[model samples]
Target: MKTIHLGVFEVAGPQVGGTLSWPHPRSRSAQFHDLDHWVHIAQVLDRAGFDFLFFADGYGYPSVAGDLPETAARGGINFPSLDPAVLIPALARETERLGFVVTSSTGLDHPVQTARRFASLDHFTRGRVGWNIVTGASQNTVAELFGHTTMQAHDARYDQADEYLDLALRLWQTSWDDDAVRADAAAGVYADRSGLHRVEFAGEHFRSSGYFTVDPSPQRVPVLFQAGTSGRGREYAARNAECVFVQGTTVAHTAANVADIRAQAAQQGRDPASVRIMVGLTVTVRPTHDEAARLRAEFEEMQTDETVATLYAGNTGIDLLALDPERSLEQLLDRDDRGPVGQMGQSNIDRFLPKDGSAAPTVRQILDDLKGKGTRGFQVWGDPVEVADELEHLMDAVDLDGFLIEPIFDPADLEDVAELLVPELRRRGRMPQEPVAASTLRERLIGADGYFRRPEPAAASAHREP
Candidate 1:
């Protein structure tokens, strides 16, 4: 049987699942700025044998609903977000085993800088770093932060990302030879000059001509993670990502995504099994089924309709406030007056739409469905054994590698999973009872065999001595 991997999903902000999550009495999100809060969570996950701590990030607040930022501000929806890159090293220092995956947009940062930053992080974490590649999905992100009057066309953004990744890969994989650094005290020499090569790359979106400043860390390159589920996105990920993050509203939807990604990977000359598929999963576990149900109900009650609308608007770039609540999604799609569907929005429709594409869910119904549910991932609630059973069933049904656990409340929600659910999973032999340490994040996630190995430099040809 294939071993299952587990990771915790988090964001450096006031709320994770929904707008009202931060205000809950048990929520520790208010301490987001405090290093101790992050350290405690990191330590908890590390001790629980989690494979990694995945941090989702964004550049701008959601403003798609009525083109007003006040809704997001009032609801505290993804506002006050901090850069995850700055926090990763601190978290890495606090935990010995947990890996860190930070989001960086291919559309925003230059490839060279991105390559250098992650390379440094790889060294700092001793190879416990991964990059979650995103093509800036929100128009607000491009307009407010990138100074673009309009968001790049969806396919165009992916086209740019394709080149961006190609340039980054060359910098990480080809710039330094394995034997580049040779410290010799007698000769007072630090590096073998011939072993270092300058990467000269020219692409439609990027150009770089330099050697990588940082030497190769334990992993050479951080594990690549891609969450895009569009046709272009899937192709890009299949060619590059070692781990793919996917979200779906149902089991069939998610399983289909997994199969598509694996098949695409095979087409790219990569072993389909070499790429791991992690589906998003939200859980509310208590000692008894009744207690769990009550907790879920309480969380749901905290959600407001406006908050849900604002959150969805921010994601899909469709102004929910402007649309009639009674209008069906099918009707909205038919109307040309509706604005362009953002990349994230398009992905959401693909995941949540009825299998036959005939159901017409109204705006009110959509918001009602999303209310109290913190994320798009599948939700599970019950006692430890029941939760484990659900997870195992999903795994068997979907062929998922593992799950990215979405936390409703910072440490408290995670605490329940660690204390209650984890033991149940261990008992079933679905997860390891003890934590296993690996030298690099790639080794931990996919093992050494799956890691990309750099080819050794060829020896100089023999010649007659002059």
Candidate 2:
């Protein structure tokens, strides 16, 4: 049996995206800004032999036509979004082996700024850092928040990202050399001047013409992760991402996604095996089936209809409740009565639009679908053995690399996973008996020991040239 990788899908707010259960008995909503709370969760996951904690973030909330919904605010939807990148170092300090993958946008941060920030994080965590490369989520809302008059089209942003990532890769892989640092005390030499290279690159969207200020750190470039599944997104992931995150609604959906990405990666001149794919899963495991079912019932009860609708509106920037129940999603977007539209998440909105002459899903039908799963679709409910069996089957069936264990209840549910689910996996030879503490995150994730080595000087670089 192959050991599966695990990561907790987390956000530093009242709730994760698109779920409305802040009032659940096990919710950590009261401690969204509490560092000790995060520290405790990090320690728990580290002890469980999980690989990383993945944070999904954006600077937008539920608003329509410049109007904020009272339900989203009162129900504590994806509002009060905190910066997860600022919270990683504290969590890293409290754990030994666990890595962290934080979401950051190419549209929001300049390449030089992003490069330096991840470099600092890499040094702080001793190589346990990864970047979830996002072009934009809730782009219109984010663009408005950042004072942009208009948002770029979906594919256009990905084009910008290609340029942004190219610059960052050059800075991380080219600016320093193997023997750049030499702390020779007697000679009073700190760094070998000849070993440090100053880089200059000009691209369509980004440019940098200077030496990277930070010295070489372990895994100089953070593990690259991407979470888009559109045509453009798949291409971006194939060409750039080492890990791809997908929230597949079914086994077949996930399997096709995995196959497409691997094939695209091959076409991009990459090793198909290098692009690892992960799916979102929310598990409710217990000692028995009846008991797990009972707990799952309570979780379902917490998702009231209005709150659920409010979460959908906030995330997609369409106030479905205020619109006609019979109107299709595409029709609603084109309605003159619709409010100020932000371009935060095009892929999310695109999923609902009609293709060809096919009829689009109506507002009422979309609401019903939200009631069905929304963000919690790929979940499993059962005791330890059953959950582990499903996991094994999914990995084999879909060719998945791992699962993002979205907590049914943030830190509280994770405890159950650590205690019940992981031990069973270990017993079945589906997990390592002992985890090595000293391996860098890249080594732990892919078992590639020397994969973090630097590239050749920029003069003969494989990356895009200036």
Candidate 3:
């Protein structure tokens, strides 16, 4: 049986799922700016035998509500964010086994800088690093932060990302030969110059002509993660990603996504199993089922219609405030006849629209749905055993490799999972009996055969006898 892999999801800001979470009495989100807070969480998760800590990031505050930053800032909706790359080294130093996955955008960052950062982080973490590649999703972010006068069309962004990954892969894989470094003090040689090669790449979106400066880290390349679900996005992931993050409102929806992505991988001449699918999950657990229900009720009460609207606007680039809440979504879609507009627009549509393509829901219905569940993925509210059972059921039903646990609030939500949930999972033999012995993140997540294998140098292959 496959050991169910686990990871914790977070953002380097006060809020995670929605704005209301930050103000909860038990929440320590206010301490997000403090280094000790992150270090403590890292240690806690490391002790709990988590596979990784996945940090989601964004470039700008939410603005789709009024095309202004005030709503996001006033609500503290994903504002006051910090760069995950800056936090990784500190967390890495505090933990030995837990991996770290940082979200970086292909649209805003240069491949050279991104390659060097992840390469250095892989070394610092002893091969426990993964990169979540995002094509910048927010139009406000594109205009205000990345200095783009206009957002690129959805498919065009993926086309640029294709070139971005091509350059990054060349830098990671071919720039430094496996045996490039020879630190011999007596010979006074730090590196063999002949083993290093320069990469000259010129594409429609990016151009670079240089050798990578960092030596190969333990994994050589950080484990590649992608969360895009559009046709172009899936194609890119199928060709390049080692892991894919997906969110769905139901088991069948998630399962179908997994099947589609795997088929895409096979079509790209890659092993479908090599790419692990991690579903998003949220849990609110207590010692008893009744108590858990009470907590869920309280959480639901804290949510508001405005928070739901702002989140929707931020994600889809569609201002829900301007639309009549009483009208059906199909009516609005037909009247405007506008397709998905942002990078994440299609995904947001998929999340909100009914699977059967029947009559569309009203704006009020959508908000009510979000209030009940907040966002996608499996949501469980129960005692530890019940939570574990729900997780197991979802894993089996969807054929998922793992879950990225979304915290209702930082530290508190995660602490509950570590203390209450993990033990139950272990008791059921759903978790590993011992810590994974693999030295690298890729191996730990998908076993030894799941890592990237570079082609052998021609000279080295020729020297070996048949």
Candidate 4:
């Protein structure tokens, strides 16, 4: 058995089903649960041996088909905007070991602001915070907020984000000394003035001319996470990210992706092992195989088609609500072939349908397979021992660092995993029992017991191993 890290994506509000008219609020506690309900749930995950609670956020709802606000309002989907990073401090207060990862797009805000916010979070949490780096996917986000009529070209956005990251790196990594902050009550000074450094950067997309206002926090920088899987996105992750998130249906596809990413990391002059790749997994565990299958069946029956459709529509950028059932996914493929989503158009289709076999799955088929794809990273729905066996197989096959656990149900679903699945992993010597030390997020991720050290290279190279 091998050790693996695990994370869960926690969304605000009730989860939407596949279609608009279908049941939008799928949570049984929709009537009783609110935002704070999620806060308490975060606390639960922290105590349940989860490495982190990763949150997926969006500035605008799925409004590309027609009017934006109307669709969001009618569906009651992701409308109310609450910056997920703001909620980290609250969660940090409730637990000691669990980490927090929140999405913040390079397109939505300036690098200075992003740098300041995440740096503050790292400080507040004592280093248990990660930024899920994203370039906004919607055109409406810019049009409504930034007064832009259309989105920048996909490749162009990545280019801008590249510069944005460079600027942020300057602020977070190069701006202050490790011992810059010296709290000396006798000297009546909190931070040593001489230890501060200024970074001067001028780029096509972003520019910074002064010293960073904040001193270096624990970990110096927050743990970096990237989800895009395009060639350009992979290169960006190789150069900048500590963790790369991948999603796919089959183990072979995921293995190929992991290999590709590690190869890229090696080329970037960084230790390939330094870049931890985590794939999303959805698990349904019970005491016995029969019980687990029954629970999985119950979840599939409860899944809402509309909710899944809304999510798919948002990703493919073709409003499934507006498309005819006969139209092929090939028709929606962008000619320029850029952006993370555009690059993944075919892969996403393949995850739902057959590759070179079907044009694309129907809207209903996509919703029907939601559970399967949700577990595409790896699905383990069975008795504790059976699920553990599958998990070990996946780890050996892909050399995966861990899984991004997506609970098909609510927080209770997490409790079930904790009760049934975690112990099995521990029994197999695949997961640790003791909570990680109260340390920085980076420290917890790659440290020994909970201490930081310079990253080391992988044991074998692409050619060396193969």
Off by over 4 Å in 4: 16-36, 68-81, 139-142, 303-306, 321-327, 333-377, 448-466
Runs in model 2 deviating more than 4 A are 330-343, 350-361, 436-438, 451-466
Tell me the tens digit of each residue's lDDT in model 4 across 332-431: 4544643334522333554544455645676544556663243245567888888878888888898788888776556566777888888888777777
RMSD of 4: 6.5
Expressed as tens digits, the lDDT of each residue in 1-466 for candidate 1 is 6577998888888878555777788778878888899999999999999999998887866766335577678778877689878998888988999999999988787998999999999999999999999887455555666667766777888888877877777777777778878888999988888887877666667777767788888887889999988778888888889999887577877787788889988887788998888888888999999999988888787888778877777777766556788876655667765655644546765544665756767777777778876355888999998998898888888888999998877789889999998888888788887987787889899986434642331221111112
Predicted structure 3: lDDT? 0.78
| Candidate 3, 164-210: lDDT as tens digits | 77777778877777787999999999998988887777777788887
Which scores better on lDDT, 1 or 4?
1
TM-score of each: 0.94, 0.92, 0.93, 0.84
| Per-residue lDDT of candidate 2, residues 334-380 (tens digit) | 76754434344444566567354667788788777667366554778
- RMSD to the true structure for each prediction, in A, is 3.9, 3.1, 3.6, 6.5
lDDT (Cα atoms) of all candidates against the true structure? 0.79, 0.80, 0.78, 0.67
Clash totals, every prediction:
0, 10, 0, 14
Better structure of 2 and 3 per lDDT: 2
Off by over 4 Å in 1: 334-337, 352-357, 450-466
Candidate 4 lDDT: 0.67
Give the worst 10-residue stretch by lDDT in candidate 2. Answer: 457-466
